[model samples]
Target: MSSSAAGRPDDPVAALAELTEAQRQQAMRRWRLLRPHLEDGVAITRLAAATDASPRTLHRWLTAYRNDGLAGLARRPRADKGRRHFPADLRLLIEGLALREPRASIATVARQAAAVARDQGWPIPSYATVYDIVRRIDPAMATLALDGEKRYRDVFDLVHRRQAERPNQIWQADHTQLDLWVITPAGRPARPWLTVIQDDHSRAIAGYAVNLGAPTALTTALTLRQAIWRKSDPGWHVCGIPEIFHVDHGSDFTSLHLEQVMADLRIRPVFSLPGRPRGRGKVERIFGTVNQMCLSQLPGYAPRGTRDRAGRAQLTLAELDTAIGTFIRTIYNHSPHGETGVPPQQRWESASFIPRMPDSLEQLDLLLLTIAKPRKIHPDGIHFQGLRYLDPILAAYVGDSVVIRYDPRDMAEIRIFHTGHFLCRAICPDLANHTISLKDITAARNARRRDLRAQLRDRASVVDRLIEAHQVPDPMPLPPPAAPAEAPPVRRLKRYREE
Candidate 1:
């Protein structure tokens, strides 16, 4: 065989005319060896070992040989055709679609491109064709859609360049509805909401709380206090707090109490834009995972009464709190995060770049607490959210500016102190409705009564079952009468003998 036939196959017209015979066979052999190893079970290392070829070399040969075939691989000219290339216009369209619609699926983009082509009277490409064009232009662009959903512009900007370097550098906080129902210590069914603060670097839950209603600044503050206490040593000075405390613009997070706490701690509380969850993407993603993997999977979990028309069985407040505590500490924090590729605990320990802890408990407390906002007392001597706040200490300052340190959850009772004197406490009727003097204590009383009734009913039913099982008569009338008569007769006989 001539060198041309052995290697390049020179006679272009003859090669085209005599099809298969003129094409280089070696390239075909290389492709056959490469293609089978691209499958799921086939290990690249095993394939490379078998072929006596490095994995990289095998991969390069596979790619080249598959795309161009034997003649192109041999660096020979094809008799009938010029070099293959994706049309420039189509390539530009694919790139544009990838950039504009970050979340659009490949199929959707292809369909969109087809529609655009139909509207503009241009040639349309199939979905596969569009995918190929995208891959050829920029492979990284094609992977953009695989990132689940596009993140918020701000959050994406922050995390795009660097990984979380240390604990307390960035903390992500969010609220989630727990699946468990809990019976409060007061015996009321409490659908406790859970708010968690997760250290972005450590993936550790710094603090968490379960409450009967929506999260409040007080609840958040308490949770933060616990988290800070746990993370720091007894004497470690906690001065410079987290650089960024990222949270959604929820009422609790935006409240004066929360802002004050962050300011006191020297931590900057960063708010995501309203309605944009991407700004707190880490926490949002965590919420998704917690709901799907843990909360929804829990047995006996019920929807909130307001949402569940079917009146399903519910876990009591105590039960729910227990479940949440376990899940956060045991499962959620320890589990590996998909993005970070490490467990949260591991990340936290490895984060060496966090700021120093503050000096004293007094300084820490000052760093954590913020001044309460001012509100005028109503004619009923109640404040915002129908909280009746009175301070005997504040009597001189009544109708005047006085500092109140109050928990957001218990707006009914404000902690009033003026010039460092304690005040008399006042009670608000219902903070939920913000009706101060209405004092609709009916619901509170009824709730208590209902709980008591439930317990009594349960006890009575058990007693009733026991009586029925023993076949005990309602009054034991006849037997009791006979026993009483015998005892009287015996006593009378003994008295007569003594006389």
Candidate 2:
């Protein structure tokens, strides 16, 4: 066949065009030998003369074709095609040298390979052969051999893409340290961490928590609590127990408390493989949106450096949280999503079935709160973290060890659970109706001590002043008191005589 004919785009012969020169020569030879038989009977002598081949060689080619077909006509590989001229173990040693720490040069590797070959009394490979072997090592394998699995995975691992079947069927939760700074309770600029839960199908943000502390299981649970329970804001209607909860293999995700909560709710917890995040792409995108859209407009947006914004961080932790909540409800949920082509809120609410929920907010709190501990109810009440907790219901369980669950932010009241059943809320008489944190308690104690010291100082000053005034005081005249008593006695004696 002609070369142009072999290079036709739609023909099987097109593959021959991709072959090297030697392979093309062999394929052409086979085609020439087979072409004559497919056509009218042609003289072998004429074919031999046209091809400049001897008749004996043509006969041999025909015989080989009849025996092995096209494969027989193709050129045979040499006997020593893959046999290494140098020591067989030398290639492995070269790869090892290439992967060693403080990597050596190719020349150094060649020299080392030669040394090993000399010691073993085997043939040494040429520089080109050694270089080829070293260059052909798989990059990921080489990275693993040199560095560690984490580096290799981060550089070369494949990410997973998941599509949930329906809204509320699958949800992803993760935490990210936002590129924004907010004022902490201590009045200092600090970057805050955000824990968010998003529905995979609709891309709706179900719940999130903005806090000054690092991400922990407590934060994760709180985010999930808001996600699963009914929202006070009717606009954000994505609350439900997800069929599958996707999260990274973080320590917080693996906490026993979180695991128990998932089990109680019958929500399957699906953890992405450690060091591999094929499943967390959706939530990661949401985090990016928050940084680009919402936080970038905030006053203390810290994109790259600590104080990137010109103005100081003005919003406190609570205020920043409120801002984020407002954004998620008003802007993000209502805005059209690129992938879903509709608002996340509408997509999640399109379905009609009721979501699986805890019996009440108290039941949900008991399952999700991580601060549950068995404390015996004293006659006064339950004492937790140095605060006294009291409730009328606790009078029934006095001296009995009952479990109390509470939010770390609020020490005013705790939810009581007796033998896995929720009892009632216990209030601290001092902290009643007050949201007092441990730091708040400590601050109040310090202020009280300071006030007591000030009062004692004032009393000391009064005592000193009185002592000073009495040290050299003029005695008041006693005659004025005696004159007043004598007038009254004279009037009383006249009245008594009349009677």
- Candidate number achieving the greatest TM-score relative to the actual structure: 2
Candidate 2 ranges beyond 4 A from true positions: 1-99, 103-142, 145-147, 158-160, 304-311, 336-342, 351-353, 392-397, 418-422, 433-499
Single out the weakest 10-residue window by summed lDDT for candidate 1: 1-10
Query: Who wins the lDDT comparison?
Result: 2
**Per-candidate RMSD, Å:** 29.8, 18.5
Cα lDDT tens digits for candidate 1, 1-499: 1222223335544543444543456545655666566433466677898887798977676555444434444435567453225456655776688667445667877988888778777778777777766566443444444443353333333443234576787887888766555556665554567887777766677777777878777667777776675344332222235678888888888887678667766788777678665545566566666666766766545645546422343566556666766777677766787877887766666644555565665445432344655554433353655345543233334355545555444465665544455454554445433443323444444555677799999999999999889994667555544444444444444455557
Worst 10 residues of 2 by lDDT: 1-10
lDDT of 2 by residue, 62-176 (tens): 6665554444556666999855676567778888988898878889999998888889988887898788888888999888988888888777877557898788889999898
- What TM-score would each prediction reach against the true structure? 0.48, 0.60
